[model samples]
Every structure is written in structure tokens, then in C-alpha cells.
Target chain A: MTELFDQVRERVRRNVPVVIATVVGLDGSPPPSFARLGATLVVAGDGPSAGSLGDDALDRVVEADARRALLSGSSGLRRYAVHGAGDGRPAAAAEPESGGLTEASGPTLAVFIHAIEPPPRMIVLGAADVSAALVRVAKVLGFRVTVCDARPAFATRTRFPDADDVVVDWPHRHLAAIADELEPCDAVCVLTHDAKFDVPALVAALATRAGYVGALGSRRTHADRVARLRAEGVAETDIARVMAPIGIDLGGRTPAETALSICAEIVANFSGTPVASLRDGSGPIHRPTRA
Target chain B: MQDILDDIDRWRDEGERVALVRVVAVEGSGPAGPGAAMAVSEHGEVSGSLTGGCVEGAVVAAALEVLASGLPRLCTFGYSDEDAFAVGLTCGGVISVFVEPVG
Candidate 1:
């Protein structure tokens, strides 16, 4: 038990993609009681699981679902019927549980598997003051952050000590190298206002299936960057996906305020929430600052 | 859960038992989302957190019970109850916690 806990702790600390399958509920035959049902299945990409659901067949089914949930980074309740028709009903209600019977006569069980995946990655493409602020805020909000920049001096450990990874390379080049590793839950932010860096980064980021891609710039810079990306053979439709002048319209001028705006935009993008600043809205900050 | 791994590992290595509690679900406005976790060692050392200090004490007690019984459980706390004297989230949000023996 200690070994298993240690392994899980290591994986979680490293931010490796993993899922914990817990049998929350069960029905029929002998319902896996809460004491017996609390088995931890450590799931990684197409790998063997550590724990079981007390039955091999049940483990196989839940493991398959856990893999899918891990890939999608989704968590929800799922029910599988025991000694039933696999429709989440009791065995007698569907078909009689018969040993060595045909497929139609097989019994099923209802097990609720909840997949707990790690937080998403947020890759910030500059180590500027705004990036520093954004990194702190993003960390607080449970994002695994990676800081990237072409200037090694700027993208140092000191600049982004809280970041999961700090890469000193051209933003586009670094992204291209690791594009295959990025998942849909990941995001890319091009905070380098310089067209030389921002334009190429935006072009490369748009190619990925990353959930959000935002570029930092003024209106004039955004227009120019769009033209440059188009010239580089990026389609207009693809270009439309980039959130230029990246952030909610908070009229934020300070670095910290701007970082909040950008983070707010990212949250809105992920949650499908309407983009509105606190000043523009009437709601309390942080659910009335819960005690 | 992720943040307190080092502490959990060190404590477990020293032959200390640990219990883990995770926020599996939440309703209304929650300070932390599902998957937020906290761990308590048999000796009463604690790390990580499931709530904004509003429910950690309750969570620690619940975790100690889970460790002793070796039975995982789901615990809920919020402000919607008429029994206002009971320990609950002062934030008015409902949080479901899962407590299990980690070691």
C-alpha cells in the first residue's frame, strides 16, 4: 500500500498524465461496498493498471474507459451493470446469470468509475514581467505552466522559478519540436510583442489542436502580424483562431492587471464563460470571497 | 494531491501512515475544483488542502478516521443545512470529499 501511494505521489508531483479510477457506486449481486470498492487504479497512456475492481472483467472494462478519460482529461460518473445486460440493470431484470452461458446470457455489474486527471498545461511564450505575473496567477489556478523564450538569459530559472519547464529557444521552434506531445487541454500564449517572435509563434501554435492560443500585441501590431502570418501561407480561417490583443477588455495598463486580464480570458475560453471584466460586471469577486 | 506528494512520501518512508482526502465534486462557487487534495499523517502532520482553511480541520478528522478504519468515504460540507452549528463550508458552496488510506 505504501509503495502504491509513493508511486502515485511521484506521478502526481511530476505532473505526468494519469487517472485514478475509483469505484464510487455499485449495484446488484454483491455491491462492492465502500470499503471494498475503494480500489485505486493508476492509469497512464496505454499502460497496465496497478489496482483492480475485484473482478478481471470489470477491471478490463473500467480500465478501457479510464484510458479514454485520461486522453480527454475528463472526469465523470459512469455506471456498468453487474449480472445484467451491461445496460446498468440488475441481472434478473435483464437476463439470468448463467455460468458458461452465451453472450446474451452473461451477467453484468454497475460500477461507477471516476477518472481523476492532472491539470492542463499552459505554455507562456515570453519571460517578460507580464509572463512572470501570469505564471504566478496561473499556478495558483492549478495550471502546469511552461515558460519559453528565445533569449536564454530571459528564460532562466530565476525568471520563472514556479514554471514546470523553462525552455530557452525560439518559441516557434520549441513548439514545433514538442507539438506532438501537446494535448487538447494544453494552451499556448505568445506574449512576445515583437513581430519576429510573435508572428512565427502564432503560426506554429495555430497548427496545434491546443484549446487556446493567444498573442499579445496592440491593434496595429495585431494587424501587421495577421498579414505576416497570411503571407507565411497560414489560411485566414486558421488565423481567425488566434486571440490577438490577447485578453479581456479591461483597459488594463499595469503588468499585474494585464496578466489577470489574460488569465481571465484563458479561463473564459476554457469554461465557455462570457468575457467580461470585474469593473464591467456587478458580481462579487471570487464568489463573495468565501470564508 | 500533487502538491503534497513529497511530504506524503517522506512521512510514509519513515513508517508513518497517511490518509488522503480529495475534493471529488463541488456545487455552487467553490474555491477549489474537483481533484484538490490534502493528506494527513498518523502523527497529525498535514499537507496540501481541500478547502480555503474553512474545512481542513474537519477534513483532517475525517482522514484520520479513514486511516484507522481503512474504509474510504465521501463527505459533504456546505452552508445549506439547518443544523448551522455543524462544521461546514462557510462559503455557501457544497464540496464533496473522498477520504482514503494512502498508506
Candidate 2:
């Protein structure tokens, strides 16, 4: 048990995608209660599950469903039935035991499996001082941060020791290598103002399904970059998705404050909050932080 | 849960019995999201926080009961409660916590 928990903890700490399925609620004759049905299944990529829910059939069904849920990045409660007929089959496969095949008459049990995927990935393009500050802030907010740059000297482990991965490669190429793994919770931040780096990086990042794609630059720099990207055949709609001059307009000049601004923008992007300076807002000093 | 794992692991290594309190849901303007966790050891040592100091003391009391009873429970603290033991959030939010023993 200790070893299992340690492995799950390590995977979670490393930001590896994992699903922990626990039987939270059950109801039926001899329903699996806390003591009888209490079990945790730790499932990861193409790996065997650890722990069981006292029934091999149920574990197999749940593990299969869990993999699908993990891929979809969806979490919710699931229902299953015991005994009656075709017990271990997937919910879709099990024919309804009621009339018209629309319902089941068997003893159904509810399993509230809370599938928690690892923190979303935040890919930072450009190994600048602002990148370092942003990486720290993002990590504190439960993001799996990766720092990428074309320059090896700038993108070293020593510079971004806290970063989950530091890739010394061209931003677009690095993004290409990881595009398939990027999810809706992921984000891309292009901090390199140089068009040589920012243009291709933003172009590639826009191709992914990352929820947030931001670029750091002045308004003038953003306008110039937009013209260049338009010349490169990027559609206006695609270009508009980029949060240029990234971060809220906090008039922040320091790297740390700038980092906060960018982080705040990311949160606002997720929560659908309007991006405005805290100074202009009349609410409390600090709002409840979310991951 | 991920943020407080190190503290919980260290306390467990030191042979301390720990109770874990996790914020499972929130209503209105709560300070934390679901899965926010805090662990309290047998000696009252605490790691992590469920809210922004708004309800930690109340959570600790609930955690002590969880440890003593060896049973998990769902606890709620909010601004509108009239109960004598009510510990409300200054932000006028309601948070539901799950208290369990971490073995």
C-alpha cells in the first residue's frame, strides 16, 4: 500500500497523466460501502492498474472506462450494475434489461470515480528572465511548465531548474514534437519578441488545441508581427486568437510583476473573466485563486 | 492534494498520524477550488490549507474528529450558518470539506 501510494504521488508530482478511481458511493443489496468497496485504482499511460475494487470484472470494466475518460480529460460519476446479466461488459455494451432496451432492471451501483489528470502543460518559448519568473509562478499554480529556446546557453537546466523540461530547440520544432500531447488545459506563451523566433512559434502553437496562446511584446511589436504573420498566410481569425502584448495591462515593468500579469491573463482566459487591471476593478484585493 | 503530498509524506515517515481535509466543493465566492487539501497531524501540526485562513481552525477541529472516529466525514462552513459551532468565511462563501484519516 505504501509503495502504491508513493508511486502515485511521484507520478502526480512529476505531472504525469494519471487517473485515480475510487468507489465513492454504492447502493444495492449488500452494497459496497466504505469498508467493503473502498479501493483506489491508479491508472497511467499504457500501464497496468494498481489496486482493485474487490471484483476483477468490475476492475476490468472500470479500468477500460478510465482510459477513455483520461484521454478525454473528463471527470464525473459512473454507474454500474452487479449480477442480473452481462455484468462485466461496458455500459454501452450491456443491453438494457428493461422493456424497449432503454433501461436496466438489475441492481445498479454508483461509483463516483474522480479521474484527476495531471496539471496542464505550459510551454514557454524563449528562455528570458521573464520566462524564469513565469515558470515559477505557473508551477506554483499547478502547471507543468516547459521552457524552450533555440539557444542552448539560455535554455539550460541551471537556468530553469524548476521547469519540468527545458528543451534547447527551435520553438516551432519543439512544439511540433509535443503537439499531439497538448490538451485543452495546456497553454503556450511566446516571450521571444524577435520575429525570427516568435512568428514560427506562434504559428505552430496556433495549430494546437491549447486553450491559451499568448505572446509578449509591445503594441508596436505586435502590430509588426501581425503584418508579418499575415504575409506568411496565417488567417486573421487564427492570428486574432493570440493574446498579443501578453498579460493584463497592469503597467508592470519588472519581470516578476510582468509574470503576474501573464499568469493573471491565463486565469482570466480560463474563467472567462474580463481582462482589466486590478486597479480599475472595485472588487476585493484578492480573488479566490483557481488551478 | 498534490501540493501537500510532501508534508503528508514527511509526517507519515516520522510516524505521525495524519488526518486529511479536502475541499470538495464551494459555493459563491469561496477562496479555494475542489481538491484543495490540508493535513493535520496528531500533535496539531498542520500542512497545507483549505481556505485563505478563513476556515483552517474549524477544519482542524473537524480533522481531529475524523482522526478520533476513524471515519471520513463531509463538513461545511459558510457565512450564513446560525449554528453555535459555525465558522464562516469572511468572503461570504461556502465550502464543503471531506475529512479522512491518511494512513
Candidate 3:
């Protein structure tokens, strides 16, 4: 049991996607039995598994569903009937079955398929004070963070200890090099606050499939930056993707508070929630008073 | 569960029996979603959390009971049940948890 758990921990540490299916509820009213409560099975994306849910047919069914759950990148409880059927009726004996069919019933097995997705990637483009704060907050949210900056002094290991990677290189160059690795679960935050770094960094970031791309600056700065992005041949659609004047309207004053707001926005984006941002709301980015 | 690896290891080394309680399903407005887990030692020491302090006390009592019985049990916490008021989540959600004794 501990060995199986150790394997799960190893995969989690390596950021590999895996699914753990635990049978939480079982209905065996008529005797022969289907699945017992507390039975667990772990399935990985790369065709590896540990433990079992008693029956081979049930394990096979759960493993297939687990793979789908891993691909969907979400976790929830899934109920399946005995003999791998979806309908609450017994399967026919003579019929050629597809193994994952719902053969119109028996006892139901409720397996909670927990999709263990890799930590979402957060690429912080600029190793400034705000970047350090963002890196810390992102780490708390279980993000695999990478801090990039051209200046070697700013992108130091000691400065951003919580960051998973500190690359002392131009942000755009690093982003272009690793563009293929970026996915919908990844985020890119351009915090340079300078046209030189922000434009190129955002251009390259927008090219990737990163789910969230935000830039930190005031309204006037973002307006000027938008023109520069357009001048550099970036499409209007791509420009719209950038969350300028980044973060929620929390009226955050300090760097840490601003970082929290930005992190909250990123979460809101991933979770598909509506949040009042400086980009959408009409007002000063910071409140007149401390409130 | 990963956060409390060291504590679990130390407890196991000391020959303390442990029960792991994991939140398997949440119906609505749960503080934590599926896969949230906690490990409780024989002496009532806890490692992780399954809720925002609404049901931890009841979960601890359930963990102690599982350790005593040496059997796995599935417990549900929510406000819908009249008898479960003392252990239900204040966030108005139903959470099903599985408690199992671990080596």
C-alpha cells in the first residue's frame, strides 16, 4: 500500500498526470457483490496503474474512465453499475459487448476519480519586486513558476526562492524557446512595465496556448503599449488577449497586494468566473483612499 | 497528503496507528473539492484538512473510531440530515469521506 502511495507521490513530484479512483459507495443489495467501499486504484496517463477495484471488468472500466478524466483535467465522482454498465440493468450474456457499454443493470459502484493534474505553469516575465511577490503567491496556489528576466541581478535564485526556475535571459527569447511546452493550463504575466520588455514578451506569449496572459501597467501605459503591439504586426485579436492594467479591482497598494489581485485574476480566468478588472471597470486602477 | 509526508513517516516509525480520511465527493459549495485528505494518529494528531474548520472535529472523532474498529468506513457530512447538524459543513454542502486505517 505504501509503495503504491510512493509511486503516486513520485508522479505528483514529476508533474505527471494521474488519476486515483477510490470506490466511495457500493450497492450490493442482492448478494454476488460488485465493488466494496474504500477500494482504490491508481491509473497514470502513460499506461501504468497500481492497486485494483476487486473485479477485472470493473477495474478495466474505471481505468478507461480515469484516462478520460486525466485528459479532461478535472476530478469528480463517477457512478458505474456492476459489469461496467451505465444503465441500472444486468448485462446480456450472449451479446457481443464493447466493454464500456451501458447494458440496460445491477449494483452501482461509485468511484471518486480524482484527476491529479500537474501543477499549472506560471511564467513570470520580469524578476522585479512584483514578480517576487507573484512567484510566492503562485507557489502557494501550486503553480510551477518560472521567473525570466534579461538582467542577471534581478533574476537571482536568492531573490525568488519560491520560484521553480529563475532564467536570466530575455523574456521573449525564453518564451519562444519553450512555446511548444505551454498549454491551456499555463499562464504568462508580463510585469516588466517597460515597452521594450513588455511588447516582445507579450507578443511571444500571445503566440503560445497559455490560458492567461496579463500585463501590469496603468491605463496610459497600456494604451501606448497596445499601439506598439499593433505596430509590431500583432493582430487585434491577440492584443485583446492581453489583460492590461492587470489584476482585479481590489485597490491594492503594495506589491504583495497587487500580486494577490493578479493571482486572483489568473484563477478567475482558469475557473471561468466573472471578476471586475481594471480593464473592464471604469475607475482609477488604485482607489483614492486606502480602502 | 503530500504536505504531511514527514509527519506520517515519523508517526509510523513510532508505531502509532494512523487513519487517513479523504473527501471523495462534494455536492455543492464545498470548502475543498475531491481528493482533499487528512491523516489522524492514534493520539488524535491531525496532518491535513478536509474543510475550513466546519467538520474537522467530527472527522477527527470518526478517524479515532476507525482506528479503534480497524475497519474502513464511509461517512457523509452535510446540513440536509437533521441528525448530522453537529458535524455538518457550514458552507451548505454535502461531503462524503472515506476513513481507512493505514500502515
Candidate 4:
């Protein structure tokens, strides 16, 4: 079990898909020691499984189902009929994707499958000082940070030491190359604050399914950028999705503080929470604390 | 689980046996979702959390049991568990926890 957990953590850190299937409930009696509750089997993308649920046939079925679940990133309970030794047949031979925990009439095996996939990626456009800070903060949040810039001098491993990858290419082009893999959990931050870089990058990023698309600019710059993006034929709905004049109104000026504001927005965006940043609040200076 | 890897690694490095507890299922308004995990060391140290203080005490007891017995066990905690009504989830959700010794 320890080895299984170590492998699970290592694989999750490396962005390798893995699933943990635990026998949480059992129906009907298998052999005296065949299937024990809480017996865990770890099926990972890298290699053979590390533990077992005390049954070979059940393990195989769970592994197959777990791999399938990892592809679409679903996690929940799975039910299989546990055919006893007297039946002399493999359990889970004709299992359905039963989701609920409701009782079953016949013998059943309930395995709770937990799928752990890659951490969401954050593509930071134009590796600036602020981008470096964002990379560090985003890494702490478990995002696979990628720093991209057209200028080779600006994008270097030394500058963005914490980023998972640093690429010297046009920001939009790099984003386009990796766009298909981007999901709603991912984020794209445009920190170039220059039209040439930020405009095209924002356009390409909005085209992707990344959940949070933020651009660093003043109110005046954002208005101009919106007009440019409209000229590029981006949809109004999508344009509205861009977090221009990016981040909450934290009144923070440092690069690290700005990055914190940006990442906080990302967290709120992912969790579907509202950002409570208003300049007109009269009461306490601090917002209500989060537990 | 990802956040507490450093602590678990440190416990292992110090030759301490450890047990991992994972919340495999949650029915209703549980504070945590599935896959939430906690690490318990042989020395009774803990890392991470499995619930919002709903059943942590009972879970630690189960984790310590796994550490001592060298065997895994599944535990269910909720208001329906009459015997453990005191430690039931305040949110009225049922959670299934899998406790296993780390290999």
C-alpha cells in the first residue's frame, strides 16, 4: 500500500494518469479471505498495478474501468456482481457502470474509483517579471506552468526557474500548439502589456477552452485592446470572458502581489465563486476571511 | 494528497510507518469531495485532512488500527451510524473512508 501511494504521488506529480480503486463494500460472500474491504489497487499509466483487492478477476475489471474513467476524468462508485466460489465464474464479467450507492439485490462488489489526472496547465504569455512571479505562485497552486515568449532573451529557464517549461516562440503560436489539450481548468495569462504580443496572444487564448483568460493592462489599454480583438473578429461573448484590467481590485502594485491577485481570480473562476473586491466598501479593510 | 507528499516523504525518511486514509465516496453535502486524503504516521502525527472536522477523530483511530494490524479497512461515517452518532458529519453527509497502511 505504501509503494502504491508513493507511485500514485510520483505519477500525479509527473502528470501521469492514475486511478485508485478500493473495495469499500461487498455483497454476497466470496471465499473467507477473497475480497477484503479497503483493499486498494492502483492502476497507473506508467506500469503494472501496485496492490490488489484480494481478487484477480475483480482487479482486472477495476483496472480496465479505471483506465477508461481516467480518459474522460470521471470518479465515483462502481458496482460489480461478486460471484462466489460456488458459482465458479469470474466476478464482474458483465458489470454495468452503476453509479449510485443504493442497495443491490444480488451479491455485489462496490469499488470506489478515484481518478487523479494531470494538474491544470497555466500558459504565461511573454515571460516578464510579473510572469516570473505568476509562475512561482501558480506552481504553488499545482499548475503546470509554461512560460512562453517570442524573444529568446526574455524566455529562459533561469528567469522562470519554477515554470515547468520555457519556450522561445511567438506566444500565440505556442498557445495554438498546445490549445487542443487545454481544458476549462487551465489558464492563460497575457502579461506582455504590449499590443503586438498581448493582442494576438489574447485572441488565440480566447479561441481555446481555457477557463481563465486574463490580460494585464490599464482600463484605457483594455478598451483599445477590445477594439483590436473585435477587429480580429472575436465573438462578443468570448470577448466578455476575457478578464481585462486583470485580477481583482486588490490595489496591489508589486509583481508578486499582482500575481497573487491573478491566481486568486483563477481560483475563484474555477470554483465558480464571486470575487469580493470593491473600492467603495466602508467597513473593515479586510474581506471576510476564508476558512 | 499532492500537497502533503513532502510530510509523508519526511515520515518515511525517518523510518516511521505510515497509513493513508482516503475519502472514496461522499453522499450529500460533505465538506470534501472524493479523493481527499490524509496521512497518519506510526507516531500519531497527521498530514492533510479528509473532512471538515466531521470524522477526523474516528478516521485517525481507523488509520492507527491499519498501522498496527498491517491490514486495510473501510469505514463509513454518517448520522446513520447510530453507534458513532457523536462523530457523525455535521453536514449530514455520508462518507466512506478507506484506511490502509502505506507499503
The DockQ leader among the candidates is 4
State how far residue A202 of model 2 sits from its true place (Å). Answer: 1.5
Give one digit per residue, the lDDT tens place, for model 2 in B6-75: 8888889999888877665577897777556688987788988878898898889888887788776667
Better of 1 and 4 by TM-score: 4
Alpha-carbon deviation at A121 in model 3, angstroms: 2.1
lDDT of each: 0.73, 0.75, 0.82, 0.82
- DockQ numbers for every candidate? 0.31, 0.20, 0.45, 0.62
DockQ leaderboard ranking: 4, 3, 1, 2
lDDT of 3 by residue, A1-291 (tens): 344666666777677888888776665455225456677889897767889877777777888888888899777777665543444554321221222112324556667788887777999999889999999999888789999999998999999999889999999999999999899989999999999999999999999999999999999899999999999999999999999899998877899999999999999989999998778876578777742
**Model 4 chain B lDDT-worst window of ten:** B79-88
Docking class of 1: acceptable
Question: Can you tell me the DockQ of model 4?
Answer: 0.62
The per-residue C-alpha lDDT of model 3 at residue A66 equals: 83
Q: Which CAPRI tier for candidate 4?
A: medium
Per-residue lDDT of candidate 2, residues A1-291 (tens digit): 234566667777776767766554444544433223335577887477888765676778788877876687655556666653234443331321211111334454444344556778899999999999999999988898999999999999999989989998999999999999898788999998799899999989988989999998767787889998898899999898888778887756778888999999899888888878432344343345555
TM-score of chain B of each: 0.91, 0.91, 0.95, 0.95
lDDT of 4 by residue, B3-102 (tens): 6677888998999998888887888888888888888998888898878688998888888998899978878899879856778898888888888887
Clashing pairs in 3: A88-A105, A89-A105, A90-A105
DockQ of 2: 0.20
Candidate 3, true inter-chain contacts retained = 0.43
In model 2, the runs with Cα more than 4 Å from the true position are A1-4, A23-38, A43-45, A55-111, A277-291, B25-33, B65-84, B89-96
Question: Which sections of candidate 4 miss by over 4 Å?
Answer: A29-33, A45-57, A87-104, A127-133, A149-162, A165-170, A231-238, A250-257, A273-291, B82-86
